[model samples]
Target: MSKKGPRLGEPASLVRMRVVPIASVMFASALPLMLPMIANSPALPPLGLLFFLCWQLLRSEMWPVWIGLPLGLWDDMFSGMPFGTAAGLWTLASIAIDYSSQRIYWRGFFHDWAIAAFLVAIIQSLAALIAHPHAPMGRVLGLIVPQIVISALLVPLFMRLTGKFDNFRLKRR
Candidate 1:
């Protein structure tokens, strides 16, 4: 007789899949604050964090409200923007991702990175314009271009690392 224990084809029985999403949210919430500390280098684009958040939301494995609120608060606190603004934008972005996830397939790393860049650019530009309307367009473009380029280059590696970590955790569970 064959053993009836958990088998490869058996459906996963675990109920609490909260750890991965929670950890991801916390990590993303903290990332912006850490960005300024790295000196003598191009700024890290916020898109990478945004991308991870979107990916987690699309997985549909957690309450977006729970994930969105605190992460937004964290971004607000760390970013020099008015309190709650970043959080609001981030929460909105997550909601948008959740709604569109079914139509969008994150198949290739480049595609994902491109989406991240576009979203990040839009959000950052909006924030900059809102926060400092008088700021020169040149300055905004200057800051954005390099960050976008760097993020575009770096996102695939970050995605791979995060994906690996998630897979490891899932396998262990």
Candidate 2:
């Protein structure tokens, strides 16, 4: 091993474990916003939130309850939502997912996907409402329906990606 630790190409230091996951989550959280999109749409979906949930569902206790605060704050910086929106919602989602994990014994792929879909719907719906407070709930939902559908559909893909990242993170030098 190198003096500091593993070499550049070697596996990450999972003995600590926090660094890898935190870094990945932060990057994914900002990624969608980083891209220079000529036209942005509601259907773009919250890939960041999906990624975060995928990690939590994959490893139920990997993060502490407060994990969401800093990461969601990071997301808030890029998300352009009235700051703290992501912080509050992600923190809440983290708690709900944790509670569900405890209540449900079996967490199969489909089951997790369904759960993820529901959370995405709730999050997007709430965000839409926040963005358009005076508008009718129906109108807000209409605007965010595509986003919910797209995010919910991509849950499996995000899970798969999370698995890959987890594997890489856990590998030893």
Candidate 3:
């Protein structure tokens, strides 16, 4: 090891484990407020939230289920989704991701972004199914496909920027 107290990379590895967990909780709490802007934007998509969720999971930090439960409930209240529906789905997704963590190497940002896109698509489908069980599948697909693609494309850049933010304190220390 180098004589320096802890090299940049080493300190990052240590600090990330704690900091990421807390940040994820806060991010989830604040996410719903951003939905209106995202929903209204022609250029952006709903899956931006999923990108953040994916980052939270990939970091191998917090248990997303805990974050998801309350966050989803909060989303339901704000978004007018049936009570507990978003919470249930979010919690389930978080659990799924947590279980799959062992199989995936989340350090590859592109791969993580793809996964986020896939998850966003899945969420959209599930929400549509819950909200309108009678809606034609094609309509749901039409609504979701563009957003998923946009989210996939945007997630990597967002992840990079957010990852940079995570490094802010590390630079000073």
The residue pairs that clash in candidate 1, if any, are 72-87
Q: Which numbered prediction scores highest in TM-score against the true structure?
A: 2
Candidate 3 wrongly placed segments (more than 4 Å): 1-44, 105-107, 169-173
Candidate 3 lDDT over 68-116, as tens digits, reads 6766776676555588877877777777677667776544656666667
List per-prediction Cα lDDT, in the order shown: 0.61, 0.82, 0.62
> What's each prediction's TM-score?
0.70, 0.87, 0.67
User: lDDT at 4 for candidate 2?
Assistant: 66
Ordered list by TM-score, greatest first: 2, 1, 3
Candidate 1 lDDT tens digits, 1-173: 99756577654425434466556656765676665475443366664355455455335454554456676676666566687767666666676666656676554555566766666666677766667678898886676677767766766666666676566546633
Span of ten consecutive residues with least summed lDDT in model 2: 34-43
Task: Report the Cα lDDT for residue 1, model 3.
Answer: 50
Superposed model 1: Cα runs more than 4 Å off = 1-16, 31-42, 57-66, 105-108
What are the per-residue Cα lDDT tens digits for candidate 2 across 56-140?
Answer: 8899888987777888899888777888888899899999999998899987899999988998888878877786789988777
- C-alpha lDDT (0 to 100) for residue 107 of candidate 3: 43
Ranking by lDDT: 2, 3, 1
TM-score, model 1 to reference: 0.70
